[model samples]
Target: MGSPRAASSRSRAITEVCEAKLRMMGGSLRELESGKAAALEEEILRTDAKLEELGQLADAAARDLREDFEQAMELLQSTRRVKEHMLVDHRQQLGDVAERIAALRSVRDEGVKACEAADHAEMVSFLSKHASTYSQECWQLLARPLPRSIQVPLDDIPFEVAKRRDLLRGAQCSEKLARMKNEVLCDIVDALRQERSTHADTREYAVEVESLLEAYATEWEKRFDYACSYCGQVLEAALANEPYCGAMPGRKAHHWVPTDTAGIAEAKETARPQLPVAAASPRLKSQAKIRAISPMFRADSSV
Candidate 1:
């Protein structure tokens, strides 16, 4: 065996070597922990900054969306008011035209009956007395200044010799004018009805769009709230790949699931609004349908 002093010296050298190695390892471990802490702090600051930026962006987006929604609402309201006024005007005009058409038909029918019952002399006298008045009335239906070329004499001729020719001409002019006015009034009625129907369709579509916009605005307003409820701040943080409510560490994201709200259920069940269209008149079907003022002045010689 070696001397005891030599053995003790060897044991001391081994102990010193082990102590040096342990110190080196402890220094390396401290550096690693410090580096990790600094990196974690930097990540936290960066994430907070990102969150602030996202909030600002969301606010700006919400503001723009609200402005657009308000503008759309204003436009819809104004359009609705204008359409209501137009509908009222159309109804009034239609009623006036209907009454006028009925009066014209009644008077024309009476005149036809009178002409059918009259002898030649009575017929001639009747035509002479009423032809100018009837002609003027038909010309007035134009609702504007008449052309100078198509003149209707304001008064009947007093001369007995010229009565037959002038009276016949006046009656013919009255019949032609009446037919033209009738056609015009019928066209107006048809156009008015068609416009009303078109307005109804347009209103229906507008209502549908209005509903959709309202729903969109509602959802947009609640988007942040929904996000908060769904994932809490964990989703906002860069912690988990999937949504989490409370904590991100060691917690699974499989507990909560989205369910349809009452509003969504009601929307699905709701029926779309549809406006009724005006029905077309059978009498005012076509312009070519001849409504003669009298059988005597019938151009096609058909009653």
Candidate 2:
């Protein structure tokens, strides 16, 4: 295992980038908060002013109305009606604010819980305590969730099997997993198909969910069908989108995994193959032409 100090010192590049992203988001959020506060303040001021004006109007009318029964009764009834209307409006406004507060609290609680656990809680403990029940049930439905990429499932050799030295170690675990994944994928397809066929009879909301699952499963099949060129292995439908594996140790998984054409082109350019040079000496391919000895020094004079 690596030391904590080593791990902490490994890299700050990712953290620095994350900090920069958060700073940018914080700026926008602050601006939004300021705008919302300003708007709310203006609304409160308007409401206060309206209430004061209503009170002033009532006082001015009541100052001379007590001596007149008809005017007094009319003023009293009108004032009560206006007060009732204002009360109802304020109640509705309060209800809306309460609802918005509740929603915000729920969002903040859920988001924070997912991102940051209790100071003393370990990740495993937090997950065990607060993991989604729906997601847990879905995961439990599978025998074992397959890795996105190929893997050696049988890493621990059985003692009985190991007794025979002739037997191959880790005997094609990837291939076995591939077949198992295909079987599971077929089952998923069947289930999704059944859901779709009867979805029209189900509740409208349920039909949307069913259709989404059907689409998700159909997309998964495409990835599941694609094979790794190096190992000819396929991933389980649940994790079929990943395209890498540790087929050989000390080798990059993507080296054997076929990926995007652009990435392939880039790789080709980066590691271009060189042409072989001739084994003969460079002098043999020299551009200069060799000349014969001058005829002036020939043993027999020119006839």
Candidate 3:
């Protein structure tokens, strides 16, 4: 064994070395903690930036969708107006033709009865008195030119018969157009709804937008009721103050402007005053004509 003094000096040297190693380890631990904190702060900042960017993107998408929906509604409304006008005009033309036919038929019936009259002198007197009137009527009916669509007689049919065929063709054309308009409008509305559901990030926003659209459509329809005086194409009850016929000459300039739906609730509070109901029109009796036969034939179906 070594002496006591030498042993004590060796012990002091070992203690000093151990203390230095502990100090070095403590310093490394502090550095590691600081580095970790800095890295955590950087991650937090990046996450915040990403969240903000996503929010902005969502807002932009919503705005674009709303604008697109509005444009589609505008197009639908315009198309409805045009098709309604065409249907109204065609109905008027048919009414005029029917009136002329009834007049001609009355004269023919009188002539037929005269042929079978037991009194020959009375029959002759009746024919003589109406001869000039019948001739004038026939001349007037022939003077009117054929419609533009009847470019030539079909299958070499008589001119009068061809005119009647052209009129029938026009009626068929109107029916086809009304059907097509209804289809297009339905497709557009469905597409708008689908797009809204797809792009909206939140359910609440989607419902709100959908409600607004429905309210707008419903309100506009409620305010304007158009029934054609001639064709019986009734969209609804006639507007209390407005003329019922949409196809009346000099009425084309008048149009129904949809009430803005942004403040729909407010609009409902201050609705237009209802006027006293007018007497029912003669056309009201035929309201169940073509529109009743085919629901797709309605101009308002698309709207």
Candidate 4:
């Protein structure tokens, strides 16, 4: 209802009042909003930095674990190879030891068997010879063939009967007996022994016994080869050409010098000083000198 100019003046006054209120509150609100935004931005930057550091630490730990795993795997492989090589070597060594032991046992068994067989055969042959050769059958034949130990006593018995029986026994007839002697059986045994010595088998047996003794001596010599031949001292087996330190009667001296060569004894003898022959007594020498010089000194000393 008022004029146009009056309305305009009232609007201007209202606009000025609103503008003053806006100017008074806008700066404080803007400052509060700007502070809150800056604080949030700073907190976000700090959190991001912490996250980045934690991620870096995690990456470093992962790399360390991966390297350790790789190293562990390589070590396991090397140890496995070493274990395999050791197993093979040990197995081969065990086999060699077993083979050596078996060979030694075989040698021992064969030696024992051979010795037993030889003894048994010899004993059987001995008993067979005694049974067949010296029994009742051969006893009469041995009696009749009086080689040198004549024990028949043909002069004591009736000559005709003795002669007939002797003729029958001598012609290889041993069906019966002719008892006509005293203590003649012992003499017959002696004669039989004499006859046995002439046999070829007994000579062969003697030779065999000699050979057996030689074999035994050879075996013992081989067994004691490491021992000193003169002193019976045990020696080291490791030395291939061990020198003897033993004494000998021919050398006539105990030796520390090894007897590896023949020249040691000759050298000692060459270096030794020869002793002079002993002289006669002083009294005997003076008496001889006086007799050579003259009888005057002897006569004066006597007076």
Predicted model with the maximum lDDT = 3
Clashes of each: 0, 0, 0, 0
lDDT of 3 at 190: 100
lDDT per residue as tens, model 4, 1-303: 999999999999999999998987898789887989789889999999999999999999999988966776676676667666766676676676566556555655655665677877755555565445444534454455322322332233234445657887775443333332334776888888989876755565555445444553553333323445566454544533545343565543222223333333332444321222224322223333323544422323311
Tens-digit lDDT track of model 2 for 1-303: 898877776656668888999999999999988989889899999999999999999987887564455654565576667666766676676676566556555655664675575544554554565465534544453444332332333333234323443344434666788899999999999999999876743565444444444543453343224446655665346445454555755563533244344533443454321223334423322211111222322233321
- Model 1: colliding residue pairs: none
The per-residue C-alpha lDDT of model 4 at residue 252 equals 35
- The reply for model 3, stretches above 4 Å from the true place, is 1-38, 72-87, 102-139, 146-303
Which 10-residue window of candidate 1 scores lowest in summed lDDT?
Answer: 285-294
> What is the overall TM-score of model 1 with all chains considered together?
0.24
lDDT of each model, Cα atoms only? 0.59, 0.54, 0.63, 0.55
Per-model TM values vs. the true structure: 0.24, 0.18, 0.25, 0.21
lDDT of 3 by residue, 46-127 (tens): 9999999999999999999888667766766766676667666766787787788788888778777877777788678767
Off by over 4 Å in 4: 1-32, 88-303
Q: At residue 149, what lDDT does model 1 achieve?
A: 32
Prediction RMSDs, each to the true structure: 52.7, 50.8, 48.0, 54.1
Model 3 vs. true fold: TM = 0.25
lDDT of 2: 0.54
